[model samples]
Target: MSQNSPTAPFSAAARPELTADPQRRLGVLLSHGFTGSPASMRPWAEYLAERGYGVEVPLLPGHGTSWQEMNTTGWADWHGAVEAAFTRLRADHDVVVVAGLSMGGALALRLAADHPDDVAAVVLVNPGINSTNKQLLALPVLKWLMPSMPAIGNDIKKPGGDEHGYERTPLKALASMLGGWRQVRADLAKVKAPVQVFRSVDDHVLDPSSVELITRHVPNASVTLLHDSFHVATIDNDAPRIYADSAEFIRSATGV
Candidate 1:
């Protein structure tokens, strides 16, 4: 990972040990949370690749850089990169799954909703969609008044865990992200594929509403609670559980 520089992107292709058959190929597109770089998702991507699945961890446009730059961008920008990566994988593999960490999970759901027949399955780790913070309700006006807020990165329970993410959360970008959430929430029923979520029971970042919302709205959605991690469970103590179980879920869901 070269120390997983917050400035870089990450990607890997399928290296199937048995054959070159496209029909046997499986692909996954992973997205990191807002203000986070590919560093947060690299380990999972690499693990999936080693398991013979094509993986892509794209650095969202406004991420891997200063928060000031992020304030200039929003949800559409990030989701565009994800959709493009999914498109590329779809062209090469017959079955494709989308997985995400935090806000990335929202993007994954968006993909599954937008392409019901294409996305084979979905895996989310400590996803965030709705928040109880009243401040977000005022984003239409607050975004103009406040440029940023406290950062929401590195919320891992494991010692020495680092996501190499931004130190500030952009208000305008956040507002746009909330808008994205609305879009996905409204289209939740469009997702027809199997959905699996690894939720951190003791997460300090995202509340339980997200999992509740998913299981309630998205049919075929299920949850696996993480007892030993925080919001960034993808890189925390329960990360191995997420990786191994997610791989198994993919295999079972796709009949691979």
Candidate 2:
């Protein structure tokens, strides 16, 4: 089942974004956070593609258009999108590394957990497997009464950084995602791939509990704290560090 990946050591400066060595079937699948579109993960995706790793960043269902539209969708829709993308990438590439941000982190974990042997590696940025928001416990009833509330996007510490996510939080969709986390928590121990987590010290969106749970359950997982970034660390001050480390992880994990 093992396959060969990129062999040349990863050097972002040496390889331009336009050129990808097609000699090896190495690939990466990047999923954006909730309420966000592919634009949120564009920079990272482009960097990976340019570095000669096949990259695919899919737009989740009911996102980018409006929060109201997202309210109509649920966890099943979003997860299904990423799952399909993974399947497609797997067919084209010999090995695929699954990565995501925020809710996308949970989605990626779900893939790694379910298809432990299939996923070559896992990369998560502020993954949310659990939450401290007690209000979410009441989602069973609240989702039907209200459609949405205030937004949770654009939590970047950088002045000009933007995730390009929704303006409002969709209640129905939020409840569905929260429910999905329960399954991820139970299956965390099932993840067999090497996991890398990039956590922001001052993230205003996600609680630290999810990171704690991830490190507690998953083996061969390492955490890197991001001091100058917030929840959206992919585009924050530590963006370069993420890119460099991610390339390094792929090189180390697959022995490419």
163-209 per-residue lDDT for model 1 (tens digits)? 98888889999999999998988888999999999999898878899
In candidate 1, which residue ranges exceed 4 Å CA deviation? Answer: 1-7, 18-23
lDDT score at residue 111, model 1, on the 0-100 scale: 97
TM accuracy, model 1: 0.95
RMSD of each predicted structure: 2.0, 6.8
Model 1 worst lDDT run, 10 consecutive residues = 15-24
- Taken over the whole model, the C-alpha lDDT of each candidate is 0.88, 0.84
Residues 1-256, model 2: lDDT tens digits:
1111111111122222333444447778888888876766778877887777777787788876789888889889988988988888788777889999999999999999999888999999999889998988888898899899888888998899877787889999988898889989999999999999999999899899999999999987999999999999999999999998988898788754
Error (Å) of candidate 1 at residue 8 is 2.0
Candidate 2 wrongly placed segments (more than 4 Å): 1-23
The clash count of every prediction, one per candidate, is 0, 2
